[model samples]
Target: MRPLPLSDEDHQMLLKHGKELSDHERRITDLNNKMTDTLKSVDESNKYLREQNNHILEAIIKGNEKNDTHKQEMEVINRQNLWKVVTIAIGSSSVIYLILQQLIHVIH
Candidate 1:
């Protein structure tokens, strides 16, 4: 296809349009850079929050472990007290039985 020749006025209008397009491109590039920087800032904040959350989770786990250990110790103490009470009751019953047997023999 043969190229159409532009008139002088048409050439001037084309130059103005080119300048406007170049300005628009520069603005778009600047906006893209700002958006990338904002994204990076948000990513950094998210990483910090995730680390804090992990720390909190670890602390909670430690506290739970301590509570479990304390509960186990309490159970052992309760068992020991129960055994002591049972032994005392058995000894008292045996002593009473022997005293009753002696009293019956004397009466006879």
Candidate 2:
């Protein structure tokens, strides 16, 4: 029906409904803006976290490489020490045998 045919009550009711819808649209727009801002903040946080994790992973890799190098060096040192110990034990035994032999010769 034309606006001219509508009663005052119906016009007022329609105006109130339109105002309510306008208010709802404004609220929806505000909520959308806030959600966009929140999403941007979240994205920034995610990016920062990813960078930190990458740095940590790099450090771990470097540490593992150092550990491997140290292990190899320790193996070489251990082999050298084993040989030194064996040589000392053999030399001491030989000296002891020679001293005992001289003592037996003098006694006889």
Candidate 3:
């Protein structure tokens, strides 16, 4: 098959268009590379944030456990204090009665 020959001016135009196409291809390739890098950076950030959130949740759970233990200890201490108060009030009433009896005898 015979090849069709292009005139000199047509050849120049074809060469110019090919160069422009190469430039557009290079730009598209660079843009794709940049987009891929950006996605990777975003993925790494997400992972870091997830780790931080996990640590915070774990710390919160530990704090809650400590609070529960403190509450139980406080409840026990309050019960003991209540019993001591009751005992002190009974002893004080007995002493007051004894003193009143002694005063009445002395007056008589």
Candidate 4:
């Protein structure tokens, strides 16, 4: 079948629709570009947050290590204090015993 010739009004309508379609395409492309920019910004923000989180974790680990060292030192100090108390008690007993023996000898 032979193609029908398009009227002038039909040609005008085709041109208008084409222009609208082109406008729609432009809008769509602009929206796609903005979305891409937004996604990149979000990715950058996430990367920075991850780095900060890692830094915080490292600091916490270091703080824990320091606390453990302090605990060990405290334990050592406590052991030393215990030994000092025992030694003082033993030395006092020895002196008292010696004095009592001397006094009994003199009385006898």
- lDDT of each residue in 31-78, candidate 3, tens digit only: 999999999999999999999999999999999999999999999999
Which residue pairs of candidate 2 clash? none
lDDT of 3 at 29: 100
Candidate 1 lDDT over residue span 65-96, tens digit each: 99999999999999999999999999999999
User: Going through the candidates in order, what is the number of backbone clashes in each?
Assistant: 0, 0, 0, 0
Candidate 1 stretches with Cα past 4 Å from truth are 1-5, 92-108
* Deviating ranges (above 4 Å) for candidate 4: 1-3, 100-108
TM-score of each: 0.74, 0.86, 0.84, 0.84
Give me the displacement of residue 85 in model 1, in angstroms: 2.1
TM-score of 4: 0.84
The ten-residue window of minimal lDDT in model 2 covers 1-10
Native-referenced Cα lDDT, model 4: 0.99
Question: What range of 10 consecutive residues in model 3 has the weakest lDDT sum?
Answer: 2-11
Off by over 4 Å in 2: 1-4
Candidate 2 on 37-104: residue-level lDDT in tens? 99999999999999999999999999999999999999999999999999999999999999999999
Model 4, range 1-108, lDDT digits (tens) per residue? 998989999999999999999999999999999999999999999999999999999999999999999999999999999999999999999999999999999999
The models' CA-based lDDT, in order, is 0.99, 0.98, 0.99, 0.99
Judge candidate 1 at residue 39 and give its lDDT: 99
